[model samples]
Target chain A: MRLLSQARVAGSVLLLLLFSAFTLPLRASASGQVTPQTVAETTQCGHVSLQAMIDEAEAGDTLVVPAGTWQAPIRIDKPLTLEGQAWPVIRGDGSGNVVAITAPNVTLRGFVVAGSGKSLDREDSGIRVSAPNAVIENNRIEDALFGIYLERAADSVVRGNTILGMALPISRRGDGLKIFYSPNTLVEGNVMRDTRDAILWYSPYSVVRHNDFADGRYGLHLMQSDHHLIEENVFRNNSVGVYVMYGTSFELRRNLIAANRGPSGYGVGLKEASDVLMEGNRIVGNRAGVYSDSSPLRPNTTVTYRNNLFAYNEIGLEMLPNTQNNRFQENILLDNGEQVNVYGGGDLTRNEWAFDGRGNYWSDYAGFDANGDAIGDLPYISKSLFDSLIGVQPELRLFQLSPASDALDLAAKAFPLFAPQPRMSDPAPLTQPPALPPTPGLESPPTATNIVVAVAMVGVALTILAAGLRRSKRQRRAISAQPA
Target chain B: MNGKIIWTLAQKELRDALHNRWFLLYTIAFIGLSLALSYMSLAGAGIAGFAGFGRTAASLINLVLLIIPLMALTVGAQSLAHEQEQGTLAYLLAQPVTRVEVFIGKYLGLALSLLASLGLGFGIAGVVLALANGAGSPMAYISLVGQTFLLSLTMLSVGFLVSALTKRAGVAIGIGLFLWLTFVFLGDLGLMGTAITMRLPVEQLLWLSLLNPLQVFKMAAILDINATLDLLGPAGIYAMQEYGAQLRGVFLMLTALWILAPALAAYMRFRLRGDF
Candidate 1:
């Protein structure tokens, strides 16, 4: 009897040791003191219970949220890594921010943060981060007033996220990404569409690269923000592609700005901006490619545009009367309606059109190149009577492309008395257009409707031609048969 | 007023047009030029990929603007003046036909000839372009064709006015050419010069520009290419803002008025002075 009782106590002790081994980590995780190994063992949160898991998680603990719709207005006050396995949705109950990160070093990834409040005054957002060193990436955020609001969050990295704004009108919609007072933020590889703007105000030293912003008001709107490096980004179908106001020292390189037609309709607009270097950008199909109002505002500052291609825009470059210190060189201005327009009527003699014996290739330049050199012998002058008249009176542009305008130009050429003063002169205009990056081709294969339209047009033309000919032949026969 | 009499007279006029060497030459030249323009526009296709239908149609605008007006005016000017010069109108009027019937029938015949020429020329070119490059925005191209037809009718009406006013065919053709030159060149240049000198208000400038049918056609064509009419600059934006939803309808109504006013004037002049 004594031996059997001792064996039963030993079995009970072994079972108790195994139970404590498993329950110790659970208790540690519950107490918010989880080590890395303990977190790994107890990381999986119950489906649809994300806030509870986040509440119990310690600082620096990593939580793997399961795939389900999790209720939101989730607050992470401690530094933690919350990763979703299969894009678990954190849906707000139609009120405040879906996910708010109030602590430093928080990483939120692979989650769909959606359904924020629609109050613009409240600035409701899908993910609102207030602390620094937050990395929010690989998330799809949609139906939110603001996609991501990084307020005073320095050194934050927002990468590979797709942000779609609400279906509100452009004026009512909030910004896709708002970075206010956040310096040294890196926004890369993100796709933003149908938002007001990806605005950065007082946010200096920000690097925005490789992002696609479309169907918005302003692609990247910078106000009083300086020292931004914007590269390899696409801004298309916006009211204005990149508008930098009250800023200085911006470098925009290799960006594509296209089809931005709105009230202002500028691909790149600068007001009171100085020391801007715009290089190798393809600005195409906008109403005005680059519009400057008092740009290079400070004296002794130069705004340089080099090796950029301005093609198919209504006005390649438009500047106010006082815009000066702008140096344009080695760029290609091709097929724009007006290559360079001086808004409100003035000459661009204050700005430099050629530098270092090289100048932009104007599609309307009629000068000839001699001695096998690419540069033209005679200086290229942009002086049109009609363009000047339209400058003074913009309503006269209604007669554009009329024969009278061409005649007026011809008369000015024949009789220099009627010729207006040259708006600009390029002493070393290029004979050949500079090589540009190939435009990304749009896929528009011919559909069945196209084929049907083509065939029908041809059939109609031939039928008309044959009927006219047959009727004419019958009339000729009847007239000949009658007495002559 | 008699349909059978008008149809008979129209058939006779059409037979005369078919036998005329200049008409045939004009049709052939139009087709050749359209084809060449289309081919030249697509020359950059090797670099820019397949040039879409919109770009090609935009390029064709200049050709249509220059050629169509000249063709329509010359044909319309000769339609009545040539018959009156050859004393065939006296013979026709003596044969139980109203003067209205002769005027309406002759105009209809010349209109058909112009339509046939334009349709054949643009159709063949359009087919070639669609076959070569994928047709991007066929509606834009079709709209361009429709605008060109309206322009032709407007110019033809003006030519009929010149024909009714003149007694000699050569004189009528001369006056038509002069009017064409004036409309194409002097009118726009004068308006531009005046606008610069006077700084006319936007509304006044728009009204003055719309007075010229050629300007209307150019604006309509540009609007078709760019739906927002951004290329027309500030004036275009102002027009869009002012007309808003009815901009297209406004253009059409203005064109119709252009056709009707000159045509009614020509009919009145012919009816009053029906003596051969």
Candidate 2:
């Protein structure tokens, strides 16, 4: 009886904690009354352009438009909240915008906006926002040039919008949230497909979270943007999934990027991007996986990856030579043919065995961890072994995994799973897995993993530079003699 | 074979391209169209009621990829085949140059022409796009140049190879088209089939793909870009993605072979083996 009473008391305390956690976010939101009368008092419901519906409104106003097909090219410019009643269809008159807004602290919810004409110039918007603080939620936009555009808007939120179209097969078209020079925007819980790029941002500090993006050139795209978070999104069969563009710093965490290969395409393309954090995402069955290609003029872009689960992708995580200063840590990779090869000729720090000298968990890792934590404490280093042999020997990746794979794992420690030495990871000895079983079968027999692939190209700038140095030539010649 | 010879040949090709304003116009059109598309593509995102729907369809990745193969074929068709069609190769070869030198020189010239086309055409297009898009990927812009270079070299080499092997202009064009289609379209399909039948992981199949230079070049370019590293499914792709240059050594070797073997074969046939 006493134990039961104690248990009830503990349960009550836990329930109290749960209740606070749930209510805290709601409490944080600005307190407002949501009565229809209060909303009517705040807004001016008139038969005007879509912009008027937004401008003539104040905060906490829900503009209930009568059931009528409106015109296209409308603008919203205000800090007001508007909600359409029933299926309030805003139709473009084949010329003007359906809804154009330039307002801060605005929300446009539950509307069907469609039927805009296409033009070579004058990009039409189904629901365009010029305000920084805006939210276009729970809206269905279809059959317009651009479904919804957020231009030069910052710190906006676009949630629960379904956008669909086929404007031009070759040309990029209709967007759910086309954010140009917009920053700190959140596009969450939307379904976007059959367009050019699903959720694209030129501005930084954005989040495309919990969205379903399918059948676009790029599912979620960020170009020349930075500081974005892409989480829990489903990208299906897009040309490429979640393309993080150049000069962008972002985190693609806990998302499904899959099946993004159809009718001439790649899965994900990252060009000239830097300072990336990809964590706990599931990249599966795509044409390729996370490709980063930069130029010679472009400085090296840095990326940090951790705990990502990748499977059935082509060229998983490709980094070029111009792209320097990138790191991968503690990822769960499985069923891949070959893992972790580099191109573009740059420095490679294969510190798989750094943290407690353990490497990432690869299903193809022939090595074993005698201990259980599923981490091979020994460094799993296959430093360009296949590349070195591929010249004279054609069938290199034919037989087993890297024979010269000097893969090893350190003994299980309290927190060292690849205790990175600044090169591979930024902060040494970061967080540890909540709990990991010590892997018993780790550490493949040591072979020559560091077989430097000395490609003596006739025209490559690096090769010419190497030839310019005489003493280095002698060293290279000497090394070439029993190197293989 | 030397830099000076290649440079001179490249200079000549640039001169030829300039003289042929029609050819120059072709590139200019592509550049203008692509740039214009960049602006028009964004319009969908602003269609008022349908802005949300419009943004979802813009896949610049696929659009760029679609442009490449066509670019390769269109540019490659004009290589030696055009000169032969104009009956100018015989005159050039008759002048004080060895067949080997002429072959190397013409290939170099073609490469330079391709570079010019890229720098002026695609590069300008990319810049225009960057300006218009207000936030475009610089990496993709640069990648377009790289892909153009590698693809042009491959196509140029193939053109040279076919031109050297055949006396007929029609044959050269036919062969060039065949090569382009096989590489750009069927190469991946073939490898995919092989992987499925061989029951090997895609990474393990890369060694076999080395035999096919087109697949190798595609893979190499992909690796060079480093953006699609994660998209590569096999363990090999992972290795390439992580240690792209180190692992791409194989593809580089293959690309070198892809460029060199055809050029070398063409040269060998032109220099040593008498035709007629």
Q: Which candidate gets the maximum DockQ versus the true structure?
A: 1
lDDT on C-alpha atoms for all candidate structures:
0.81, 0.55
Q: What digit string (tens of lDDT, one per residue) describes model 2 on residues A67-166?
A: 4455545665546556565556877777655777776777888889887666526666677788788888899988766767888888888889998764
Best candidate, lDDT-wise?
1
Candidate 1 lDDT, tens digit per residue, A300-398?
Answer: 998999988887677889888888889999898866778888998998888888999999888778888878589999898888887887787777777
DockQ of each: 0.42, 0.03
User: What is the interface root-mean-square deviation of candidate 1?
Assistant: 2.8
Q: Relative to the unseen true structure, what is the C-alpha lDDT of residue A140 in candidate 2, on a scale of 0 to 100?
A: 91
lDDT of 1 by residue, B214-256 (tens): 8788778888877776666667778888987688888899999
Model 2, CA-based lDDT: 0.55
Instruction: Give me the displacement of residue B35 in model 1, in angstroms.
Output: 5.0
User: Each model's TM-score?
Assistant: 0.85, 0.46
Give the range where candidate 1 chain B is weakest over 10 consecutive residues by summed lDDT.
B43-52
**Candidate 2: DockQ?**
0.03
lDDT by residue for model 2 over B1-276, one digit each (tens)? Answer: 456554555556656655655456656665566556545543421211111111111222333333444454444455566676687876876776656566666666556655655555454434433333322234434554565467567656766777767766677667766776665545544554455466655445766655655545445544444344433333444455556556656666767777787777766766754432
